[model samples]
Target: MSPSETPEVVLHDLRAGDGLPLVLVHGFPLDHRMWDEVARFLPDGLAVVAPDAPGFGDALLTESEPSIEGIADAVAEALAARGVERAVVAGMSMGGYVALALAERHPGLVAALGLVDTKSVADAPEARDNRLRIADEAERTGSVAPVRGMREALLGETSRATRPDLVAEVGAWIEEQRPEAVAWAQRAMASRPDRTAVLAAYGGPVSVVVGVEDELTPIEQAEHLVESSHDASEAALVLVPDAGHLAAVEEPEHVAGALARLHARVTR
Candidate 1:
């Protein structure tokens, strides 16, 4: 996509505070509402901007190719629209792909990074093929039912066993997504490149967060991220006990605290 063809991004701006802006990018097949729980616990004097990635939420992707780079460009444009020169970028799951893309494509715009329940490596061949299959199913059915099987995989054993209400809430969010959007997001994630180099090159404060019980993008992924950074000593890794893939929702207070610490470190 060319500069002229870039689509306008939909932003959920809570411009209620000061300090450096914190931009939150939600995961695939989900909207900015994914950050609702975590956002409430953020420290005062920090501006928060959560944007809907293209083809997800109310945002539409104008580009024919639904690449993660395209989503990153949209995020950069969204920040520009808000007059934000630089900000800490936090992303969960597929949102992590877009965050890494943003850091790689628009390095100057990212002041810091908060990666939650995500990995720096690209999808394996089998994973890519599976994603394509899921996308195809979604397109064929005109429904997100194809991916609903992942609901249990997205949460921890504890969450599944104890917090049925939270699990149901997450399922509801997943069910509300548009099939086309889900397909587009799957394709984008499938095509993403290994972004460990981006972390190795980034100089800002980095926060690597993951749920201890997360079946997908587990603790090892978070550790790898911290270890791969330019200065491993500077990176902060936080593990949320009994949480799963959706760490932000499962343990909002912990996620928010990690973010707040990262923000403080960056500002200091």
Candidate 2:
């Protein structure tokens, strides 16, 4: 395929394959590369595409203000550009917020939702305040330290001591993020409207994947989502063993397996 015919190789783009289209949205601090291993392990005939949010990875960082909804719109545009009318959209953490936003705003483009290690609740006032404080610190001293602290927070307690290398890798990814991008995302997340209604309102299939050891978005959060969602009885909940926030990176095989099961349930 000619380069122009293919999706732009930026922070995020469409990976070429055949069967159903699966859009993977990476969590904060990491780019689409975070999904590389999980994408490789997906079922054959699945066209896996991981799009990077603007300002992260190779995405062309414009001067636009950042918001999860804004990012979702960008993804929708990218998919339209690629002739993809609908896709099974999967997102991790912040990506989940974007996926839900996309599904809500452009109902026709999202066939299903795969929410991984994420939540449906909006940030509490304290949480939003904390984020603002962190953003201020990041702005003052660069985003690397705050992001490193965030990296530590995302990992399971055991990972800090047992999987230092993984922690380092995640920290490095955060450190590599452009400061402006990080700041923009922080503000966007703070300003985001509550999306619990989206979960309750959407009628399409939804799957919630949580890391057993996740501290950022705990199992309780997943339970809350499953209970609150419109398709609670049918929505699937997966708890990946030994994985933390970044389940796809921490336990790629387990995440891939969950995706396969969700795919079967949603597409079959």
Candidate 3:
């Protein structure tokens, strides 16, 4: 009953009565705090574990060059140590990449899947180069200033206009991240391969949620995820209205409801 042997508290664990644990992975340059609000609205007795991927949060910052595979492995080991043999895995943005990798690497570890505001394709040539450039800057300056303006791209038009406080809040979250974490994430993301095949191969119940106004990974990206799934018709799709890439943070209640529904499908 005690996780005394678990390596360390990764980020947040609301381990209520559990059948299958719900593992939430956060996006890049940010930590597990991004999922806190949405985690609150999930159904009762649903165990939730939100872990900061490797270098991003309270995790042990390593000198290892980050890779999605490394992040995926870290998540699996952490969960296994906590007695979670399998889980309903969900992630947003960079976290989604990690989730897809997790399912790919761990095979039977994922019982269901949730992808939010993320794409299955690798970065285009230009995008990959830009990420490396930012990584270099972050590592050199030892700061997140290189990616400081990401709030504009991460939030949707409506949220950006109406929620200045939200904008600032997200920015603050970015600023708190360690520069090494930021650099590690950028390089890891830049090196990720196209994972649409991961979706195509996965047979578990799948749900894809996105902010309606998400410009970075727009609705088209969400649609691609659903369509790429093994059974497209069964995949649940939830688009958070008036939100953007960080939909779960911008509109936690709605995203939480979407996750709750996904959980029902898995648990039922």
lDDT of 3 by residue, 196-244 (tens): 9999999899999999999899999999999999999988889899899
Candidate 2 residue lDDT tens string, 1-268: 4311222225343356665688889888778888988977887777888888877888755766557777888888888887888888889999998888887898888788889999887899998997788778777886557777778887777677799898988888888888766776787788888788888888878889998989999999988888878889877898888888888888888888877777666578
TM-scores across all candidates? Answer: 0.96, 0.91, 0.94
TM-score of 3: 0.94
Rank ordering of all candidates by TM-score, starting from the highest: 1, 3, 2
Local distance difference test, candidate 2: 0.80
Candidate 1 lDDT tens digits, 1-268: 6634655468887556876899999986788998988889998777888998776777875655768887889889877877887889999988888888888999999989989999999989999999999999999999999889767888898899999998898889889888988888888889999999999998888999999999989899999999999889888889999899988988999999999898888788
Q: Which model is ahead, 1 or 2, in terms of TM-score?
A: 1
Misplaced by over 4 Å in model 1 are 1-4
Ordered list by lDDT, greatest first: 1, 3, 2
User: Which ranges in model 3 have alpha carbons more than 4 Å from their true place?
Assistant: 1-11
Error of 2 at 180 (Å): 0.8
Where does candidate 1 have its weakest 10-residue lDDT segment? 1-10
Candidate 2 matches the true fold with a TM-score of 0.91
